[model samples]
Target chain A: MQDIYILFQVAGVGIIVAIIHTVLKQMGKEDIAHWATLIGFIIVLVIVIDYLSRLFNQIKSVFILQMIL
Target chain B: MGSILQLFVIIMVAAMLVIIVREQNESISFLLVLLLGIFVFLFVLNQVEQLFNLFQSIVSKFDVSLLHLDTMIKVIGVAYLTEFISQLLKDAQLNSVAVKVEIVGKLFILLLALPIFISVLETLMSFIPQ
Candidate 1:
């Protein structure tokens, strides 16, 4: 459920970043476009890291019972 | 069914977007594909949970020792987690790192199965002349 939302958010970010990069490049601001893309990548990476941490926690909780025995 | 349809739609959209972006930015396209892969796995996670619950119920009715069952579950979990991580690594083009991760996973699984192996060896030894 929440995962679906996160996926959409990531896709949105990717598309928006790509658009910004193209627009900035067309305007002869290649450096700023590059920076925008990098920032977008970092933001997406942060979101993915958050999701991965949640997944790891879930996995730990699920296997904790098995670990005790 | 509905969720699967939704996932299919999302993947289709993401794939088209990746193709469009690939001309301009290769890494971002790759990242989009990676994210889609993760989402697809998560979409099936509910089924995995149900399967685990079924295993629990079935195992509970048997006379098997809880220790053995625990070890079995742990081994399966280890396999699953290792596969997931290894696939992610492969997606990132870290092939060697992915192989290392798989080797480590196999080692951990082997360690987990050691108790069962020892018990089987003991049972076999009991039938020996020595």
Candidate 2:
């Protein structure tokens, strides 16, 4: 639902960042392109972590088992 | 909701492919192509819940214990995704790394299924009337 909107936004931002990085690299800006790639990955990872945390909380509430080994 | 999102992903990918095949700048177009593929992947993830529910229903129709089914699914998921990742690594020309990763994944999956194998052996022993 609302989460889908977040997903779309994250995907869109990632694509834009990739395009920027590619354009910069083609213009011989290797350093900036590398930084941009790192930033894009971090942004995507942040979204992933947020999504995983939400799922973890939901699963914890649903399952009372303390076995995580 | 999930299907609509999937439709959007397909459209974007198709557009990106068209752009890549006709475009002169292969590197930039390739990067865009990669971005589109990743974006579609991210979008398809929103359907994970639907997939889980469908799996749940299919598992319910079987006579197998739910926990066993879950474990089986977990192992399968790990194996299948590892295969995907290893292939991607190979495509990137990291064949040695991919081989190592595949070996590690196979070992992990074997370990994961150990309990099930042990339980089956125990059941067989009981039937032998030791």
Q: Judged by DockQ, which candidate is best?
A: 1
Q: Indicate the DockQ of the complex predicted as candidate 2.
A: 0.12
Q: Where in model 2 is the C-alpha error above 4 Å?
A: A1-69, B1-48, B54-64
Per-residue alpha-carbon lDDT of model 2 for B1-130, expressed as tens digits?
A: 7778766866575565536432433333333333444444445444654676677787788744666756665565566546655875665567999999899888877887899999999889999964
Task: Summing lDDT over every window of 10 consecutive residues in candidate 2 chain B, give the lowest-scoring window.
Answer: B22-31
Residue B91's C-alpha lDDT in candidate 2?
A: 53
Q: Report the number of clashing residue pairs per model.
A: 0, 0
- Per-residue lDDT of B45 in model 2: 45
Instruction: State the C-alpha RMSD over the true interface residues for candidate 1, after superposing those residues.
Output: 2.8
Note the residue pairs that clash in candidate 2.
none
Off-target runs (Cα >4 Å) in candidate 1 are A2-5, A26-28, A64-69, B1-6, B62-67
iRMS (Å) per candidate: 2.8, 7.8
